[model samples]
Target: MFKAIADPTRRQILGILRGGRRTVGEIADNFEMSRPAVSKHLRLLRSAGLVVTRKDGTASLCDLNAKPLRTIQDWLQDYEAFWSDTLHSLKKHMEEGQ
Candidate 1:
């Protein structure tokens, strides 16, 4: 998952899916790159479990699967708590010194 989202293009593709489902062509339209390049990004996102794709007639539609992001959020929350505590301790130490 980390490897997939590490690319800026893949991240942008994920952002586009957040608005709702979009055809592959709709997504490709947002970028200056070729449709194949955009499709490559979508392939990575699909492998990472961040994007789900379906076939509606001839168009391929994509949607965001945000469940994987929750794991990232939980990981960041741990760091957030640690930083908050460290800042609080530093503030207390500075006030005590004064």
Candidate 2:
């Protein structure tokens, strides 16, 4: 999941999906890259479980699967708490020194 989202292009594709479901062509239209390149990014996202794609007739519609993102957010919350505590300790130490 981390590897899939590490690329800026993939992140952008995810962002597009956040608005709502979009066809592969609609997604490709947003970028300067070839349709195949966009399809490649979509494939990575699908593998990461970040995207859900379905066939709507001839068009492939992609939607965001945000469940995986909750895991990332939960992991980051630990670091957020750590930083908050560290900053609080630093402030206390600086005040004590003064």
Candidate 3:
């Protein structure tokens, strides 16, 4: 999943799909790339379980599954804590210098 979302293109796709479901064509419309290229990105996202698609009459609407986002968030938690500690130390050092 991390590998899939590592690309900037894929990240933008997620952003486009953030509000609600959208057809592959709708997603392709936002990018300069070919529809097949967008489809490939969607395929990777789908394989990662980050996206889910369902038929809406003649179109397929893809929606964010969100659990994969949680996975990414959990992975980022360590970095969040590390930054928090570093910021705290920096604040203390600055206060001491003052």
Candidate lDDT values, in order:
0.94, 0.97, 0.92
What is the C-alpha lDDT profile of model 3 across 1-98, one tens digit per residue? 87988999999989988978899999999999999999999999999998898888998899988787887799899999999999999999999999
For model 2, state the Cα shift of residue 62 in Å.
Answer: 0.5
Off by over 4 Å in 3: 90-98
Q: What is the lDDT of candidate 3?
A: 0.92
lDDT of each residue in 1-98, candidate 1, tens digit only: 89988998888888888899999999999999999999989998998899999999999999999999999989999999999999999999999999
TM-score of each: 0.91, 0.95, 0.83
Per-residue C-alpha lDDT of model 2 across residues 4-57, encoded as one tens digit per residue = 999999999999998999999999999999999999999999999999999989
* lDDT accuracy of residue 23 in candidate 2: 98
List runs of model 1 lying over 4 Å from the truth. Answer: none
10 residues in a row with least lDDT, candidate 3: 64-73
The runs of at least 3 residues in candidate 2 whose Cα sits more than 4 Å from the true structure, single-residue gaps closed, are none
Cα error, candidate 2, residue 7 (Å): 1.3
Clashes of each: 0, 0, 0
